[model samples]
Target: MSASNRPAGSGRLLTGVAWATLLLGLWLWGRGITDGSGASSAPTTGDIAAVGRPHGVLLPAAHAPIKGTAPERIEIPSIGVRAPVVARGLDKAGGIDPPPFAKSQTVGWYGSGTRPGAAGAALLVGHVDTETKPAVFYGLSAARPGAKVRVVRTDGSVAEFTIDDVQVFTRKRFDARKAYGPRKDGRAELRLITCGGTFDRASHEYNANVVVSAYLTGEKPSAGKSA
Candidate 1:
């Protein structure tokens, strides 16, 4: 189920051409995206079939974009995730390198892209499970709209975001731009991604991906600093 703890290279999530395609979409359309539809053949938690903003759910307004520093840590309160963030770039194969399986609990940020809390969408990827057990983002599919995600920056500010959309996009229907691009211009956005759907025995990979989208709602000043 864990792709032997190797989520990227072993035909899991961000495999060779798939990763390149994603980056291409990100480059072609720098920011802003619309909602899409689709579902996973193998559902997890609840029905994850392209769950967008729930009806009647009033989300907070997007916070103004801020100058962002490198993220030191990330917290998803609903999922009980508190993990360190590490910068990751393209590997030799030209695909976005994910965090090593040995450090399955860590989160990998696309260092070359927009920083979290910045004007554009920041990309954060993690493994859903390991060979032995669930990994960092195991409960990502269960995350619903209105969940809170907090990113602690190196500069000491804590950027808080509210989840707005969650989708289980199958490989055939996955839109890289929609999954990773900003939802609105001039507002900071975040995407939490992991492998989802059922594991394909033939391909040795997951059939779908779980993408959780969020936007900055507020910022807590650095510790001991006046707001």
Candidate 2:
């Protein structure tokens, strides 16, 4: 994705700090963000064209970044996703250890990375599906640009993000920096990631990843009501 994927004039750089950490994060993320169950199931990933906003869908102005806060839950009304958030770190293999398959409905935040509502891009990852059923982000690909994504934080504030871009990047074209970096400097951003593309039973993993990019556009003291 590029500036065209965001509202005009919203460009930013991936600071050295973000770049260096993302290098290691991407290493594991690109190898395959999540594992598969191998059993045949309906694919949940979307097409590559999912990138960029739909023609004429105007987006809202960016909201000033807020103080760092831990996310407690995530809600995407467009997709009917209301899931609890959990903090997860790198596994022994150096890859982000996502919420276990048994907890398919949970979302995992990169606890070591940027906190939600902060300047850097906060990353939340989840499984797309399992051998027998759909997972937390199963309908993520179906989410359209301009839709709202609300993150309930621990500080009694809710970080509201507007969907700006959604892309399905295959392993070959998965650029860690571009996929995970902030779209606008100094503006709070969020990246929702999950295994996408066709599930290769032989390898037991998906061929691509669904990356949903959003930027902070609103906030409230708590999840009092919908925006």
User: Which portions of model 1 miss their true places by more than 4 Å?
Assistant: 1-50
**Largest lDDT belongs to which candidate?**
1
Q: Give the TM-score of candidate 1.
A: 0.83
Q: Which ten residues in a row have the lowest lDDT in candidate 2?
A: 10-19
Error of 1 at 72 (Å): 0.8
**Model 2 scores what on Cα lDDT?**
0.72
lDDT of 2 by residue, 87-157 (tens): 98876756565675567789999898889999979999886765567788888888889999999998778
Can you tell me which runs of candidate 2 are displaced by over 4 Å? 1-51, 223-227
Ten contiguous residues minimizing lDDT sum, candidate 1: 10-19
lDDT of candidate 2 at residue 178, scale 0 to 100: 65
